[model samples]
Target: MVKNPLKIFMLINCLGMYDWSLSAKYFLNIYVFASTIQNSGSQRHMHFIKKTLNMEIFGCFALTEVSHGSNTKAIRTTAQYDPTTQEFIINSPDFEASKFWIGNMGKNATHAVVYAQLYTQGGQCHGLHSFVVQIRDPKTLLPMPGVMVGDIGRKLGQNGLDNGFTMFHNVRIPRENLLNRTGDVTPEGVYSTSFKDVRQRFGASLGTLSTGRVSIIGMSVVNLKLALSIAIRFSATRRQFGPNDDEEIPVLEYQMQQWRLIPYLAATYVLDHFSKTLFMDLVELQLGLLQNDKSIRQAELGREIHVLASAGKPLASWTAQQGAQECREACGGHGYLAMNRLGDIRNDNDPNCTYEGDNNVLLQQTSNYLLNCITDRHQDKVRIESPLESVNFLEDFKDILGQKFMISRVEDCMDSSVSLAAYKWLVCYLLRESFQKLNQERKSGSDDFEARNNCQLYKNLWATVLQGSKVLERPSWWREFSSYKPTVGSLKSKL
Candidate 1:
């Protein structure tokens, strides 16, 4: 409902700092549930979006099953078409097939966008499809017949959110409930889509999926901002032993303290810029979807955004995780107290590393993206590029890999360009080595799965870090940075 993409994400992110559940409410309503309906559903679903923004209806996204998390294609929840009634029978065949980790379903959501393996009356499984299924009564807040739903109980943090689980026992929804923009079933029991290839349809679907991962990049950045505010502001005021015996100084004045915390501050700025840019890229993708642009470039745009969001979430989450820990430890005993909110920040950030997508597994998506580009360049004899031109620099990988770090003085390293050059070389070097390692496994009779699984141990591409390096520079107010006091409530960038 919020028109500006940047402000929408920023507002959700800042609201998260106040209380994660509050932000999760908007995030689920707008980003995850409604956004999917907007993209993959037709005009009939537009009113759901409006009602959700108006608080008339609440919703949850049901995709991850109890037994399967990220392996979405293998999920067992099924929606079989019954042409006789013009309805889809949604079912959870077993306990493991139940929808798990569903936000808002615990106690509040009145409906869900349930994903199931769609089966036609002819018994052909047509892969995953989204359907709007009402799970709770709007007034009573009780589960509907054949709907099993409840909260997951107290968590380490973000307990404000009623995270829950669900199962459906032959629950039937109208044929029109299906989010049918990508794939739809006729009342006569046939599955059809505008897309000629299943792969193209799947590619179109990634745009809806990538929205969460992309937004989390900004969420993680904001976490770092909060932790940095508490730590840096504390460092600037809380005095300790100084150069002289009688004169105590702020802990921040010490070289060691600065060394430990300053890189994270620098990282915060780098990541902030990276998060915003990645967000804008996703905005461009959604804009294309709005216009219904199905060009090769549009398909490629989804893929490129997917690749960046996949990796950006991990980098931002991990960086915030580390930053939170460092900031907490830097505060010493003061940080351990709950009122200080360090522990809350640390615990809230832990889920970011796992949710949306696991930090480690998502990086492989980036690795695979880079590999596909490399493969296209070599085997297909095509240029390595994207509509975003993110990995287009790989066209000069050979030249970049040929270069060496030649900086010999401390002064030379002060400029961030030195770091960026070294990082470019490192990415190119790691990429070529990873490519060789994967090929070696393949040549050794390893199948696609084995090749990928075996090569997971290898270091991989870092496009997010590439962006981070570009933004990591000394503050223009470095001399006056000692006067840089962070605001208590607002986490605004002075630069």
Candidate 2:
């Protein structure tokens, strides 16, 4: 390890941005790039150039295009091999298909890890794969031949970072440019991969979803913390109606205000706890993958972890948005200012719901994955470990759902012991609802894409509903709240 003090300080000082989305992206890229290089030789020079020198080389993963953001399989950018030159020719064939909305692509990127459909000899089209293409010379910020890149201009938020649209017209990249960890092709045009199953291939393509989900959870937690800190401090100081004519009371003293804010306080606390625990689960999953465990348990864990993170991110982002708005109202006029940070936080988080994968589209992946598990149970197949084992409601499937709210506290809404009960109701309800809607669309003679689009409305509705239920039943919130209690009793004895 290099014992440079200056680099240590730079790394230490990076956590200053409390809830900013761009800040989180900056941090993630830093950590990921470091891990990528220090731990492996796959992209060492790229990492060194980007981070070690403070050079602003924003190399975004160019997966999503203008025409299709979440739908990766539908992207049209083509990469054709030139056997004579030993290079690949990349192009966006039409207007609707250019790479769009990629961070670091606009003005700062010297290179991009672009994803495109690979067409080889005999015209066999391989699914999406990444290529590290040189966009600009690292020293000179000019575009390379056959590469077109520029910003998408101002966005809803995170405008400090330039996100660009890209078009590739006959761009030639050396044969070695491909990241071939999952799949590879030879000079003779024989394409092969370790994963023969297309579903597994697609899953490998989206393995990064774990990190994306983790970042969203962390970002949402930070946003919630900032909002709650502001609101809590402001609530304690702000005066409102009181029983006596001569006196004023703090906003927090009111039951309604307590109902609105304190529950969220409890919620924010819980989500923080949950995020940390889930991160540990992810760490284990990573270790399992690295160890080449490849047991049925490992695959099951990967799917479950993806489901948890996907389901959890939308929940946190939506909560943060609501919490920020409530915090703004609680702050009266001050929260409206951009400097107060609530509004900006809200705007930045808005894209989280739609990006990475549309929260709705992603939930279906989780539900589909989970429903497959349920089908396995129905078929009397032996099963591997599942996070749902923590929730007994899934086993019974009949007893607790629709079992009356019993009370109206936020705590009641998210009772940990019976939390899975709510989750069952939420999932079964949405699953059935989506099925019914999809069936209706098909019965009415709509095509597959049209039916899927129409079904998306229910998808959004059900995802939110399911997430809300999970929050109440899971122990994440209560555990988080418990940690904040005064531990003076135990500390005194130790002292």
Candidate 3:
């Protein structure tokens, strides 16, 4: 599985071109479900692996509840420990507690990895815990008793995949059904874990969360590429007004068209590389965790991976959103035609911004990680030693900020090195400014949450936007100029 990350991503990308709904369905069922089972430890879930791999059992992940989407802690579904029966009674107390928008749960999936608040026999709620719950009878193709499941109606797009909702009413399952790799209950109804800190355990339990975001990054790139390919090709072929009475020029010749499309074209290559690099990093982290290699470096690498996934997913998805819109507009009215496929691309890619994690909320995670890094630097707690060296520039933040953009001409501003340097400075400036705003908010009597909320305009938006732009812009500049060769009679080129 570690060796297959790139292959898996490429397959998803290819599948996305044919039909996004198909790719999304397979991605959720195979990638997300398999990742969860793998992370839950094979000792207990090997049977599940065998059944799923053999195609005898289909599964979905049930995490987001009707009342709780992003806030996993607030989900009200309960798995109460029944000590006498040695089972857990999974129940949804109210309508809001039902699991919503679960892929494949509407009609097909036989089981689900359900996340619910676990309560011990003593009435102690043990944060969020995952359990393998049977939602349907595989043989009869009917909903299991006490499991209310059905498809949620139409969506904006990707309608080929069934989005579903589920509610459990006094459903009983064996205690061993719990995904107990992170936390577990004793036969005597005691809750215990190797990790004492709840936050640490939460982090550990998030092993499967990053996989969806990583796949989304790759899928977004695929959508962007598809959009650009159509727009650029059509621009090159379609003709418009020109100087001569009988002559018409291809839209690609227009400066405005090139300016509009080329940057996204450049971004495609840049994000493609970034996504691949991130996929490899994730593969390494997954292997390390699977092997139980609990070194400090591994822990730091995990944090870095999480931060990158959070930031990169939003970056890639938003880029696709804007790029698809541009592609649609650049194609004139024809782009809106169903035959052109741009509208489908736009709608299919839109949900990515909100699904895995809302883009805005995800950006906050990145900003918080950045702020923590800055704090650690100032307090001399830890050196800025990112495994990917993404944050190493923070070490020279002062130097970077002091330097100003010195390009003399518009052409100079187009220079890849100049653009990259400017981007670095932009990120550094935002980081410093955001830190200041957050500190000021705290000083003005706001609590941590309120201060963080208040600083979102400066911290979250700037940090995520600038950092993501820098990531794409740097490689984009390199790929754009590095591969170009000038003809002898052409205008002077930077390369």
Candidate 4:
């Protein structure tokens, strides 16, 4: 965890280039699960943590349900405390309540940190709680009695790791299995926690969720890097028609190719930088968890991380998704070949846009966070700030809005500052506009849900680079460009 961020991202880039499935497998098996137990599990869970870190035992995280994906509070699985038996009975009330898309559980994992609603004596459900459940035999990998587990067979891509689903039918575990860092149930069925506020308890319990999404941002950048590396190299070397029969030039000489591939190249570097920086901020959040900060600032840090990750994941994943497609198309027939790995890159990147959280849903999450910021700014006079200082700029929204975009010369566009100023203005403008829209929708009798969704279009402005040289020059062409295509009889006939 203390490793250099650059080295880690570089490793992710290299491993993902060879195959994204390996990169995913590495994270799902080693990183997130370890962090989850550390954050949510108690001292009694030390042996499990030690074995996991030593790679002596395998584990997976089972939180997402088949029926309820994002709406975690409404998840249907239950873990009821049996006072006389001194055990908790875990059950999936229906097929829909079964956990789905659990990584590592499909084949290798013997244990899982299963999330389910905790019930005490008299069926008093105390919301969602995590429990350490042994799902398979240590030596034989057989499903434990009362548990029905199976692999979710193939899909779009990243099939190297087996994803799975499982349902529990009165599966029983000792009362000590509950990961009760935030809240715990007594052996006598008494529930107690430091935070009496249910919202605070929920926030503290699920703080680790943001970490997984933060990690996904880096993975997405790696996919973009791999795609850009392959496509840009191909563009630079693959020759096209020349100015004359004796003269030929690479397709990279064309402006269109540069326009298509160079931006993504720049984006990879930018996202790479952001991913590293964001992960460093993640260290602060993890520190608070380990120290049990329990302060308002710690709670603010959690909210900040959630907002950033909710937005950043979509930004990086969608960028990678679009970049991969453009790269595949830019390479023409070569990109389509499976051997080249371009198609693999594209398919692998596609999952990022959906998993962890769907990009569209994430965009709405970001918007809701923004709306809250603006509302506080307007009504409570609370300063727009975050542990990461990401939203701090909004405090001067009035000034930013007042500032005008005034670059007249085309030469000014080459200066990075020019675009940056315009981008800031654009962001401020959108924030202001969306806030008003939400108010307008509410005035027109729309609920918060409807107002938030309606404002998604304007709330999506977030992160982009490049400049001069012999840059935009078309040195030679007829080989790959349109200039020579008309002359070729084979192509001319088609035209």
TM-score of 3: 0.91
Put down candidate 2 lDDT per residue, 135-243, tens digits, no spaces.
Answer: 8776777888888888888888877667788899899897777666556778877787877688776665566667567667766777778778878887888898788
User: Which 10-residue window in model 1 sums to the lowest lDDT?
Assistant: 486-495
How displaced is residue 488 in candidate 2, in Å? 37
The sequence of per-residue lDDT tens digits that candidate 1 reaches over residues 1-495 is 436767778889879889878999778977788888888888888888897888788988988888998887798999999999999999999999999989888999999999898999668998888999999998899999999999978987788888899999999999999998888988999889989998777667545778888878888888899999999899999999877999899999887679668988888898889878878888887877877888889888888888888878877888888889889999889988899888899898888988877876787788888887787788978888788787877899888987866654445555989766776676777778788988999999999899988888564334444334223333344433444443422222322
lDDT of each: 0.82, 0.67, 0.84, 0.79
Say which candidate scores most in lDDT.
Answer: 3
Q: Arrange candidates by lDDT, highest first: which order?
A: 3, 1, 4, 2
Off by over 4 Å in 3: 1-3, 406-415, 467-495
Show model 2 residue runs off by greater than 4 Å. Answer: 1-25, 31-57, 291-293, 380-393, 398-460, 469-495
User: What are the root-mean-square deviations of the candidates from the true structure over C-alphas?
Assistant: 6.6, 8.0, 4.6, 7.1
Native-referenced Cα lDDT, model 2: 0.67
How far residue 486's Cα lies from its native spot in candidate 2, in Å, is: 30
